[model samples]
Target: MRFKNKVVVVTGASQNTGVAIAKRFLEEGSKVLINSNVKDDLQEVYKELSVHYKDSVMQYVADISDEAQVSAMFKALDEAYGRIDILVNNACHQGIGPTFEEIPTSFFWNVLQVNLQGTFMMSQQAVSRMLKQENKGVIVNMGSNVSKRAIHNRAAYVASKSGIDGLTKAMAIDLGPKGIRVNTVAPGYIFTNRWEVLDEAIKERRRTNIPLGVEAYGKDIADAVLFLASDEAKVINGSRLVVDGGCSAQHMPIDVDF
Candidate 1:
């Protein structure tokens, strides 16, 4: 139990990667607070985890992009946990469809509001709380390999993730001396519930593109996040840990050999 008794807050914990991270932390003996904008989904996850973890797990509903909601959530966390030890900024607005030109300006800003500004607001609150505590803290931002390599239609997502990379580094430098570490975990293709409805051909094409011939599961990404948040990564800061099955390292897909 590396995180035994640690106080962890994981945003976007209603499903998929967020739930996985919260579960892993709970298993490691952390007092966890899970947050999601969706009340029903968040409650469902809370009910499931509360069965196993009981008093160790709690849930909060808030849109991280909204400053008032973010502030209120942290205030509630303060009442519950006293102080935070680790923060996982896993909430995101995945800008999946529409090309850059085809996408509406409102939609683009909406993506930025949630993905970029949300991260900033969350981190700002986390750092404020951490600075007042006696122990150092860790912040793990959920990034994407697409931050480094652009995909076909996710222009807003790519831009926001790329911004996160820069933000992580900036925060690390500013907070390192104050006993805080900032880092990002960028996953390429992780198998989630959304993938369940995808066409087999599309899935096969994605698998073929990855050199590992497989997509990572939510647990895989959770492990990486845990490592970065643990004491094992005490010296590690301002870094991006790509958990993409070597997808970002390649010049092209394996089938596209010249």
Candidate 2:
């Protein structure tokens, strides 16, 4: 139990990667606060996780994009846990449009507000709280392969993720002196429920493009996040841990031949 007695906050834990990270932290013996903007989904996950970890879990529903709500959420966490240890900024927004021109400006800005600004807000509060603690803290921001390489139809998501990489570096430098480690876990083609309905041919094509010939499960991302948050990463800071199965390491696989 690496995280025994630690208090963890996983934003956007209603489903997918966030939930997976929360589960791992709980399993490692941390008291966890699961968060999501969706009340119904949050309540359901709260109950589901509470079955095994009733005393170690709590649910907080707050839209991370809203500053007031973010403050309130952290205030509640501080009251409950006294001090924060690890933070997984897994909350994100994907704004996809048929074409660049088709995407509304508001939608684009909303993605930035939640993905970029939300991380800033959460980290700001977490650092202040951790400053009072003896051991300090760890912050793992969720990034994407798109942060390094651009993909079509997701200009907003691409921009937001790229910003996360930059934000991770700045936060690391600023907080490293105070004993906090900051890093990012960037995943590629994580197979979530949204892709469950995709055609088999499309899925196979995606897998073929990856060097590992497989998409990541949400747990794959969680494993990377936990590593960066653990004591094992004491000297590693300001690094983007690409957990995308070598997807970022390759050039175009189709055009090049061995």
Report the error of model 2 at residue 19, Å. Answer: 0.7
Tens-digit per-residue lDDT, 177-212, candidate 1: 999999999999999999999999999999999889
**Model 1 lDDT-worst window of ten:** 249-258
Model 2 lowest lDDT segment of ten: 249-258
List residue ranges in candidate 2 displaced over 4 A. Answer: 255-258
Residue runs of model 1 more than 4 Å from their true location after superposition: none
What global local distance difference test value does model 2 have?
Answer: 0.91
Relative to the true structure, candidate 1 reaches a TM of: 0.98
- Tens digit of lDDT per residue, candidate 2, span 1-258? 889989999999998888999999999999999999999999999999999999999999999999999899999998898999999999999776656788888988999999999999988988999999999999999999988889989999999999999999999999999899999999998999889899999999888888998999988888898899998888999998888878888888542544
After the best TM-score superposition of candidate 1, give how far the Cα of residue 70 lies from its true spot, in angstroms: 0.2
